[model samples]
Target: MNWPAEAAAGCSCAAAVAASFGAPAFRLLSAGLALLLAVAVIPVCAVAVRAENWRANVYNEGLPSHLVAVDKNRQTFLFFEKKSPLKLKYSFPCVTGQLAGDKQELNDLRTPEGIYFVEYKIASGLDFREYGGIAYTLNYPNPVDRLRGKTGHGIWIHSKGFGLVPTRGCVAIGLKEIDMVGPRLTPGTAVVLAERLDESKVPQPDNGTARELRRLMHAWSNAWAARSRKMFDYYDPDSYSKATESFAAFRQNKERLFKSLAFIKIYNREIHALEGPGYWVTWAEQFYTASNLSTEGVRRLYWQRGQDKKFRIVGMEWTPRDVGMRADFQKGRLVAAALPPPATDASAEAPLPPRLDMPEAPGETAASGIPAVPAAVAQAEKLLAVSNPLVPRRAPAPPPAEINWGGRPGMETDREETPPAAKMPSAPETPPVLPEPAPPATPQAPEAPEESMAPEALSLTPETRAALEQAVQGWNTAFAARSLADMAALYDRERYNRLPGVPRGQSYNSVQRDLERRFRAPWLTLISRAPSLELQGTLAVSRCEQLVVAPDGAEQGVRTLWWQREADGNFRIVGSQFKPEELGLAAHYLEDVSNAVSADLEAWRKAWEGGRLDDYMSFYAPDAVQQGRWGAKNIRRQKESLWARTRPTLVQLSGLRLLMDKRGIRADMNQVYADSTGHSDRGTKTLMLRFDGRNWRIQREDWVAQTPQPVGGSPAAPHQNTQRAMP
Candidate 1:
């Protein structure tokens, strides 16, 4: 046997083999050694396989399918791919905040350590040196960070343009590394940021912490669906305040919603738990339906162990987009139908599992401490309640504090994605059997809270008050100028139709016409004074004494206008009501007004028959359009000329009727007229009347001939027929 020179120089083992025995003995010993080495390696490989399986089954199964883990201390970026086994797919060097510890305020230069998600991507408008070419925006000040009173925004994961320099409260990696992982960092991708990566902290499949969190999640959801006041108790007041406008405001808004919604149903599925450095997060696909809306999304709740060692929800986040929860629920139902029934005899069954009646968190405890929630009771409470009684969304009343009814700038609370309006599906006649004890009765409008107990209504800022006054002044200016275009610009046309005293069918166009007639007088003067304003949410109410002076006389009254804060942050007149009693107009019932209108119609007929031109003209409004004539003046002139040409003999009216319409009181009647010229005609006449504070006058008059009626010579000429036919 020959040993290679390199093996002889490098292998003491080769020399030892040669020295230990002769060639034949060495061969036999080598065979025995090989067998022993193979036997040892087999067990080692088996242990490694079991370890991998343990990790997959215990940790990965309890986490989201894909995860982006960033270790600030280690300056490492990790990506767990979306695979059935959820294995780490990539690891790369990264850059974190320049300073140590979590971010606490704006410009803190410290990265936040918590669970967040990629909110969006910034593809353009990049400051190359600062943010690199491409960046994925992370929801920093995530609910947990917000609750902890940590501030700072614009946190992102981006490629590093200036080498691997530390970022200002952000995570940065090499351009090549980012490009490789960019596709997986889409919106709603879970991102776990920690000070250090510690395997010990990873959650196990059925650990105590995970089980307790599940129980808490179930209870919280049940309380919400039940509309129980206990739902609010799950939140840590001190921490929750930092995340919302105020605890009181939050409670008030939620209470209002609970009362307004006839029923609420919340179903959570595919729940997963993740343990961060100090907090634990449980997230799941949530399907929520209320009387007003239905939304499917992912919801995450951050829980922290308090000083008393009890876990409580510090904050929460919701991503409102369909997550197939409904479809999955249907599939689950089908699968459940195929399952075998449970054993009938209780004694024959195995021992029952331990209950999850854990202690509740502090600050929400009753005199009896934490309430017990045994497994049996929890199972009984899991069924959904199905009732959908829609509550009408009213136009917001004027409010002192600015409100975000939908989406307003600077709204404090983060709102889920809600459509402007959702069409509600009719509820099924029979709902699934509810939990043993029924939920609260059908929603009732809660009584207003006592003043002392009511949440403090935020007072409007001076700027808002000034803006409202400016809007009112602008409207007054437009009114005095008689500029219809400018007035239209200041009014929300849709809501403007609801103005008081404005007849139903009358639009802003008619209002403009009426104003034109009012301002027709030469040397007219208008004054508005003593304005008082009140606010309720986006709506503002302004009342002022208004005076109108004309050639004939002066009219004074109080004008009330409702203004709403539009999406553009400007105020516009929505509706207005005038108090005519201030101008000494008598208030009368509908019947009395109808009778008065009838009396006026009769007197007008008499005036025309007696050829009293002045009295006849008096019955028409100053700018009334009569018999296709433009004004009362033109109508009077035409009537006078026609009467002079042929004297009136007789006039009769029958089948008279009066009805109220959008315009005003409208009178319909059959009229018979004959002149000294020995001509007669019969027709149906219509008079559209308007009331000018004191009396009703004809705003419009029309006549339709009932064919030729030969009471005398060759029926009356078409052009000079009935009372209104004096063209």
Candidate 2:
């Protein structure tokens, strides 16, 4: 790929967008990968504000924090919060020495460092190959990393991934950290990691690193502060100044954003180095409108020094640092921070499995020649259109990191197809009682130093065997449901396992607490289909497809997952993946657009509600694609799509699962879309939605019509609507 040209195109697109609003020139500098290059075209004219939707928030408050790293050399690192007089120690299960690295490739593991915080948290299968729970990636390798001549790769964290052992070079940690920090860490949290952890390396809150990050905040704030398009340093040269057409658009938008807030300010900030040279600093944008309406989730950020040497922010993420800020400006306080999309590791020539836990590469196809999809698979490809979010997906996080499950049968970790979000049919005549199966005859966690597991004893009596079998099945089903009650009922309550991917001091129980809290609410919905269950004695795997939705109509699909029957006879999700749709381009676009909208989810929502369709459409490429039952086409297809959804159908939407990226949004709707006659479908539809540089629209779909067919359709009477029957 032409990196320079792509970079230039991004710079121009961003500059042009900023110019469109008659705002100062904002240019996209060298940072991130082609994925980052793909979103320069998102329009900033019509801001859509969706306040009801929730964002995962991460922050820092002079707390004790440290970064740990493990490399191919079997070397590990723990960088503590040096500024704090208190130096605390953290211990974690280790999994180092994956790749057979040469001296020249010391930095190939691609660990990163920057002022970043955890965007979101989820039990990502990619994080743990052996025992997996949660995983979080550091917002690393900021633009500065590239400019500083640091070019390993990013997404440095510790987890037992979904595949076999191999990392260019990175550190591994427990699942506990991912859950504890991923969601709480927001944009602007400092994430810095180096080979050394001495006091000298401590970033004194006012160090140059801090200044660069604050400069970013100042730039964005100033950008918002100004209405004239000049008085800025960034932006493409040719389109440096706004032409007449662009000037008009900029003035309209600039006026509203600048004048609307009754009160606004930076709420909170944090700093950290997630890995090597990758630092991040997050700032919360808090506001209270004069009308008594208020917002606390928006987070503005600057990712300085990615792979780039200068401090150019790759993008801003959504966060909730100011959540506590009250709606009443008269008496306000902070709540929680907003959450941003999960981040993805910038990949290069290094070989990686589809999931982090899987040991073997599916097949070593050259990364340069990654294959494209064929026409028959267009439906599947559309599902793939969702971007790879920065946080653990709404449900399934990243794939489990590769682990050595000790070449055992019945013990193999399953691939992540989707989260078990769909409701299963009530027991259908209770299937025949099957005999107990063996536990794949092998352990599935190789990288886990073996201490987590105790000595095993085989049990073999017909009655005892049957009892164990039934118990395992029951537990499996509960996990499949992902129900708060069912999950809580099965919690060990004691002797919990630290799985992998979380921060050092956090507890796994906190993850359970968060999941329970989230599941208790109706804001997020899972969008998975029926699960196909398997048994390998005490070990079991469930492969399923699902849709996860947010309060608004946003959705994401989940794929494969594996779970084990705990000693308490309850089931817990052990490993999982975020790519249940397997649709090409979905992961790519999800990350790009989610990153875009997350920075301003509420703004985008308001624009949509106000019917700023043209301005709304600017968030995507002019050449954007689309696919759905209404059929597929270019930008024009929206006409048909809008007519179909808004037409007199009775789809009752409870919560929408949204997966996003820099380009736009992907949503899984748990729609009870009623028939014009009023029957509800209670299932889900997978929509590959996106912004085409103007408005949020569908670029593709793998939507199963799960909408139920009403009773008594005429054999051949004049058709009312010809949509497929609900599954």
Candidate 3:
């Protein structure tokens, strides 16, 4: 309105107001408007606030954020990792490893525990190519875990929506958990897991009445060792009087423990103090046995320091080995005598209990009803078979017969491939012992077909590109701020497709709701850094490590990317790979701060190629399921039922790659494994891999047999194979 004042330089403040009024047309301009427009158009935070019943911030407060359940058995494998600031209830379903065939053990099937991170994220699994709409991968066995010598690797916490069901060892939650819990997980989300749910705590209806003291002991013992779910009715909610009443639960747990028929005698009972009915209960389990051999020793139980801490059983120092059990039969006799006679025969009756079976001699197989093999060495046995290759496979080999090929299917062929020059040939040179052909004459690798490969984009010298590195950091910051559509606009439309903003119905309300769901996962931290970007002329590859922190205040890392370029660029990201572990320079970088790849390459290849897949896969979780290049990228998923499925006759394991720190060891390895599957159609495959702490597994398995390309020019990116819960 005041033209003179607005135009004059003398009235500077008035000119500022005029400039604000003249700002861009589409959107209003002001300090507050900028902040509101930044995160996303959808009001995600508000909706989330309304939905969340509880509030906790794991990062800032450093407490248990939330409980995580990997319910596998009856959908009950509740492995809890607390995420602080959890405002709403989060639940989802998942697929599990294959159920082991025959009589397998607990260590077989791999439902992982400890800590992990969401290392990579996708709008879809490469298995479905662009058809699938969103998934995330977790860094399961990290580098910090070397000391304990754990095995198995390449696990994911992805979407069930990625497909219906089935996964090697990945947890497939509902899309809600994907949107809600995954994104907030920075690379450091602590994942504390139990092998399965603790059966001892589950309450059941009262089966019968208890009268005498001995009956109570048996019931308690059954509850303690077996982790019986039937005893849940006994846990008193009133017992938990405070914010934490774990101590009360511990007391009830003890009573149920002592009630099992297997329970011996309670030599001592000491409760220093009591908060309500619960106090720290420290006790012992009293027996150890061998086939015909018998011995007894004490296994002490350690109580939590206070009533609030989780209950743990551990033996204390100075507690005599004899205290756990008597060295002779006298102690057992005495314990039996001390138990007052049960009130009735029904009270003393014991159910048929489960026990460990001993191995019998080979010829004794018929007597035990189980087959056995001889222990002595036989002349035909091949030794020193394929272990693992610490280096590449292309390295020159020694003579054929000189190397041990193990029980691999094509062992004879592999041995035949060895250089003849190193071998003592039976016949004289018929044609000629010719000198090696010149290097140039040998065909190397196939050239990249133009149809499959993307062209280079963003013409810039390394010097100018350096500036973009800094700019990328800022761009990521904006991306983190919920600029979903804005970030997509920066991508070259020619090469990529952006996920549509969240819809209002079954999906979500807007991009903010979608991003907000992703934001809940701790692994989606600080998305503003410039990941490694490679521009191959017209084809650009931008890669970055996903830094995640666990609920335990520990950090885990993942690898991911965005592939695109300018509007005019013809090259595009038609294909993508879901590689979660930080391999190569990325792994080295983990050690730079602090940890860990696949199972097959490390387990089978290292063992078979070198000979240890049999013993190696033995360590694989019985329901050990593996998905890789065994067949097709997306089609080849293998679930090992037992030693039967893997059929490892004999193999060697070597070149253990382990990571060490003050806490313990995080193991990574390269091994060669070969075995006889009793079939001519079979051949051993090589694998390179890492350890996730539970079993020796195959991580990255690029087969000796090249994965076949689809009829079309390019190879279709594979989707992750999934396994369903058996019970």
Candidate 4:
């Protein structure tokens, strides 16, 4: 009401009443009404004031002011304000993976539960239908995820224009909601992903596990700075081996750096920790400087609490971005140089890097340990004033016709095309960049313990095999004849250096000198039979039974020679391993046997390409299986029938990788097949070969069909093989 106007109107009405009736009677009635009005207004005004205070207090005391939290179980995405006086700025309905559980391997449709950070925002060049014109990628497989041997890449918080459809290990929300929250998710912003989140259950400031993790991180960092071997002690060697590179390889690399650099400086900044389902993630912005290399990046260390109630680092993830470390180092060096020398003879030790001082929990009161309100439910009375609708329940459908040329089938392709001259990212590079995961596989039967490939069935062609035999004989003759030129011509110094297991302090020059000394011995003689040769790509391995005669005595042994093809297209001896027969046992030359199996694989490919049906059939064992047809006879019958109709014109194999396990030698390679009918297809070919006394025969063959596309194409985006467990 307008108080002045109402008062004037009331006075006019009172005057009129007084004039019409008796003055005393009108005055009494007016006073009585005014008293009644005052009595009603007093409590209303008081209630209004109290309600405002309550709203303000609720905001200040309740909620976490700054954080992004995702609850997979509830399908809620919450964003809080960065400023103090706790408030939940945005709450939106979201959808996670259709399946539940933590992601483990590639293509596993389950969101990983962990703490991560927004690495970057993808605003364009994405499928509008799939990504809702914007997406933010989270750094999954973060250092901790990698340490756990978790595989996959490309987990993102995105929006889909069609609907909030459940994702394949991604978090999705509405378009409007994402647009509002996207700006706040800057690079390095903390993101906590959990199966379920409850603000009321937030841990207190002094979380024991988090503190222990921080201590462990400091100890490891200190050891690294000191260049001490104790650094390895912090790592779970067995887990580290499976997660990233082999423990030996990692140690060797670190040791080499430790010996090479005179000093190392590491400063960690903005350290924070977040507890996940079963692990804790501790991350910091790290600045590293060595003799020649300087880099700065965000490093996340994943720790698992053990049975002994101790935390140990299991894996680590690094996000490299320039943080001006080089400039900082130069500036610091200049300042230090300007200072005068110490007066004492002995220089003072440098101060250690600052220890982690975690911030206390926000809004703790004396009377109550918890905040004024649980962040997730601050305004329970008006919770859905602005809320996203639930995602429609529907199965994923393929997008409409689009020119997704290079991307995997049914997925979006990049809008921007690169020039022909630009280099394309290959399959090997996907593991580090593309977020993906794997699935459980059936266990395979173990093979014989002493399974080794025979020399005769090596991958070498007949001509190459014959040449290798002659080369071995010539090497022996050259040694006996004291022909230095002949012996030198057969050796490849560079290739020899690559040969593993070479004795320490021995070099190509030393071996040559030793050979020269033996050449001068008048009674020195070398006799050797034809050598078994295996060729994989340009590298070959040859094993020979040899007898050496000297003035003092005679000796017999097996000589294993490593050969490499030189620029001149000749196979030259790169390295040699010798074991004496006096031990009454054969040399355990497993490496040699593996190489021979690879050679046989190449021969098998050659036979297929040449349409040598009999030879190709012979490569398979008597009980071999191909494409579900059991027994070699059945497999051969199918192949013969197919070949009669359309002969293979080209059968090319590349990227051959062989793994020798207890079951047999598993050979995986990319194969391209073309036939007389002009049909051409490509796929990954996996052949399981078992050594059968004299040859490595294929026991089982499997082919996974793939639509061959130019690398870096959209089609190849989601098609990536699992990264090798060992580096």
TM-score of each: 0.41, 0.32, 0.20, 0.41
Tens digit per residue, CA lDDT, model 3, 543-591: 5544332122222243333344333532233223324442222122222
On a 0 to 1 TM-score scale, where does candidate 3 land against the true structure? 0.20
What is the alpha-carbon lDDT for the whole of candidate 2?
0.34
Tell me the deviation in Å of residue 714 in model 2.
66
**In candidate 2, how many Å is residue 665 off?**
3.7
> In model 1, which runs have C-alpha deviations exceeding 4 angstroms?
1-61, 82-85, 198-206, 326-727
User: Judged by lDDT, which candidate is best?
Assistant: 1
lDDT of 1 by residue, 362-459 (tens): 44233544233333322322221111111222211110110111111111222212222211111112212222222223322222224322222223
lDDT by residue (tens digit), candidate 4, 254-362 = 6755776555556665456666545666766675544423345567776775566556666665544433443443333211111122223421222233432111134
**Per-candidate clash tally:** 9, 223, 145, 28
The residue-level lDDT of candidate 2 at 166 comes to: 34
After superposition on all C-alphas, the RMSD of every candidate to the true structure, in Å, is 32.0, 29.3, 30.6, 29.5
> How do the residues 1-727 of candidate 2 rate in per-residue lDDT, one tens digit apiece?
0011111222333323333331111112212321254454346333211111111112222232343322222233333433354342333333332222111122432233233343322232233464354433444333333334333333545454453233334445555543333332322334433323333323333323443344334344434323223212322212211111122222333344345433223333232212222334444444312111122334543343433354443333442222323332222222222222113342231112222111112442235433222232233222222121112212222211001101111111111112112221222122345544554453343222254564133334465445444544454455435566766554444433434321133244675676666555433423333445554443445554444433333333444444444566545554444453322222222323343333333343334334455544544344443222233334335543553554334323322334432223444433334433444333333444444323444444332222122235311221222233321
In candidate 1, list every pair of residues with a backbone clash: 397-536, 398-535, 398-536, 398-537, 398-539, 399-535, 399-536, 399-537, 505-662
Candidate 3 has an lDDT of: 0.30
Please list the C-alpha lDDT of all candidates, in the order they appear: 0.55, 0.34, 0.30, 0.52
lDDT of 4: 0.52
